[model samples]
Target: MKTNINNLNQKSIAVDEFFNNALFDKKKGYYSTKNPFGKKGDFVTAPNISDIFSEIIGIWIISTWEKLGKPKKINLVELGPGDGSMAKILVRTFKRFPKFYSSAYFFLYEKSDLLIKIQKKKIKIESNKVFWIKDFKKIKNGPVIFFGNEFFDAIPIKQFQVQKGHYLEKFFRKSKYEIKEFYKKAKNSDEKKLRSFNSLKGLNFIEYPELGFQELDKIIKKILLLSGGILLIDYGYLQSQNLNTLQSIRKHKKNDILKNIYKADITYLVNFNLLSEFFFRNNLKVKKVVTQKFFLEKMGIVERAKILKKNMNKLQVNNLERRLHRLLDRKMMGDLFKVIFAFKSNNDDILGFD
Candidate 1:
């Protein structure tokens, strides 16, 4: 379903707008079309990679709930919960902490109905307690400990390139056959950051997470209202810089972004620097960004693995070991994926940050 741009009376649109359409256009969006996860799909996530990932996250959730005074009823929300593997594992693990498990309600926010069906099949343990939210309004105001793994990166990003000391916004042209760049002056409050980066020579490229920032702002408000915290894990740079991280993945292999719109998963690296600044400016408590390896290690992944290996067979142990290595390998997800935490107050020290 190719959108007719001229029919909408538009010759060109900003990069983020184009990306939003290609990924969430209802009829032709990548997520709207089919399941895009696992070995058969475009790529696999940490949760799908191994249950150990979610076990540690489950521990983090329990720790956060305890820190939040263990509210009788807490809303445990997961944004972009693909296939619900994480949620399923989390519920199973929560059974160990009966107080937290019984007090928790699962709220999932997913845009695709097809994937939602798959999530339903995978998530059967807490089916009675699970609620699918169409919008943030449906989530009741309570202690909300939210998790967003690789969620922010999927949000559309606007690309800007510096040319001869002038910033040009990248835009896709439907009138023509190629992408176009237009010289547009900065109009946002964050223009000061641009001025600071002006001294860098050569072709400087930067991505602005305007939509991601807006979504996070809304999420922060929800968490703040409930006096709760958020754990966001994704592959990105801890410090912002002039570079392009837009990438395309098809069947677990990286491909050209321009290959086919809405056919492959198109995403950009998240800017934790901007996200941390947003949280701080809003008076939310921000934790020091840590690598996934550091965060998982702090959450006791190595210890957990040791305990599980005692009961597993030889092949099971080997597979488990491989998944663990992939998760902590410095050359793989370990150094690349970063974790950041934000909360409403600084009362209790957040786990996995130290």
Candidate 2:
């Protein structure tokens, strides 16, 4: 179905326009205004789902911190910390290791002003120990441990479709109020890559978040400069050649991505393979890439769940089992979501993947 643009203001915008206006316009954007989360948000994240998720990550972080020589001042950086639930759990978990907690500095790179406020309320961090910045560039150089959960997918991506051996961009014409896919001669490199993909047939569309890649490159450089490491967890394929992964969610239900504009969450699957290549080219060592099931299972998610369920009633135990299964089920988020770790130092194998 086509979008009804006639009823919108003459300057009515598309999702990309709204995002660009909000993020880059300097004058107006949702990030500059308020927090969007919980039941009122476009979608939910793993941290919002259960404390178990963060508990596992907390263990991972502490293990990694130990490997990093237990630095006196480590930068604990989280990108797009939604509502700070994970951060709150992480800090609480780290408190068990008093030395680590005392030596670490927490930093959140977030764009949503509203979410930042909510995060402040949710996480009780000392003003001198915790910081929030709108961009990663503001982060100071140090021994860094970075985390990005379902972050890259939310970044805006440019969409393209192959037509008669040519590539065309998908654009939203404000006047037309309809999504339009038009073609032009593809760039030599882009055309070469397109030709390499024999699986794309008929009216096939592909989205490449060049901006996301660029941002990743910058972050990687920063991490390398600081002699740091990063852990990225998201739902994406390892290959670059694929069809459109663009999708939307509203009230936990999938919706046409082009339907509601900014009213819903818009995202596409991440390409971890491309991301790995980007990091490898920058001389960063890829420690490992594995499915969430394998990672969490190695991290003893089952054991952890059992411990949490030991005191619960039959119904509670059943619910906990279901949630654990859902989290680790191959057909669900387990296989779809991948975990990749890249480090500057050649330490032993990571806990979850080892």
- Backbone clash total for model 1 is 0
| Predicted candidate 1 versus true structure: per-residue lDDT over 230-263, tens digit per residue | 8899999866677878898988889777667778
What lDDT, from 0 to 1, does candidate 2 have? 0.72
> Compared with the true structure, what per-residue lDDT tens digits does model 2 show for residues 113-203?
6678888998886788788976666567558888888888777776677765567655454435464433445467765654543333343
- Backbone-clash count (model 2): 4
User: Whose TM-score is greatest here?
Assistant: 1
**Best-fitting candidate, scored by lDDT:** 1
Clashes of each: 0, 4
**Candidate 2 ranges with C-alpha deviation above 4 Å:** 1-41, 162-166, 175-177, 184-205
RMSD of 1: 3.1
Q: Give the Cα error of residue 50 in candidate 1, in Å.
A: 0.5
RMSD for each of the candidates? 3.1, 4.4
Pick out the ten consecutive residues of candidate 2 with the lowest summed lDDT: 1-10
Report residue 21 deviation for candidate 1 (angstroms).
Answer: 1.3
